[model samples]
Target: MKYTTMEQLLLTELVGAQVINHGGIKVCLRRSENIPSMGGATFDHVALFVLDGTVVEWIDHLNPWDIKSITSLKGSETNLYGSRGAYGTVLIETK
Candidate 1:
């Protein structure tokens, strides 16, 4: 399947995340309800990476062939990330 950016994100990471699909698709990562709020600044971080695994980087532009593998976690798998998992987490290995 030709994955959209949102689709790739969902596949590569962020399980248990709440997704809203209107026109394209919008992912509002579900943070813990009891953790208070960050006033919409939560998950607003995106760093571009071509290797070394990644977190919410711009993978949309990358050809699917460029991705070697994908693995993720939720509810206490490395917190999700090996170091800092989200409500869910996935690491995309680049080729």
Candidate 2:
């Protein structure tokens, strides 16, 4: 559960963000935006969960707001997510 310096740097970008590091994994509290089709609705601050290690949905129904959480991924990290990660990704643990 150890994050590399690079990871730490990424997390730092999200100033004023609440980051919970659990075994290398990083989860930040982020605010969710409204989905146009959903009638411009908004939800409470959601969790942007980042999975640990070298890698990285209902997510479709959710309209993600500005990624005010951790910093956006770059280079290889971005490649891991493809177009979906074009902006950034939040790893969530289901189960």
Which candidate number maximizes TM-score?
A: 1
> In order, what is each prediction's RMSD in angstroms?
6.7, 12.2
Question: Per-residue lDDT of 1-95 in model 1, one digit per residue for the tens?
Answer: 44545455554455555443333333444455543343333233221232354455344455665666655444555442444343444456766
- Evaluated against the true structure, the overall lDDT of model 1 is 0.45
What is candidate 2's lDDT per residue for 20-89, written digit by digit as tens? 3333433333333431223223333323335433233222221123222334443356566666454445
Q: After the best TM-score superposition of candidate 1, give how far the Cα of residue 8 lies from its true spot, in angstroms.
A: 6.4
User: Global lDDT of each model?
Assistant: 0.45, 0.38
Candidate 2: which stretches are off by over 4 Å? 1-4, 31-95
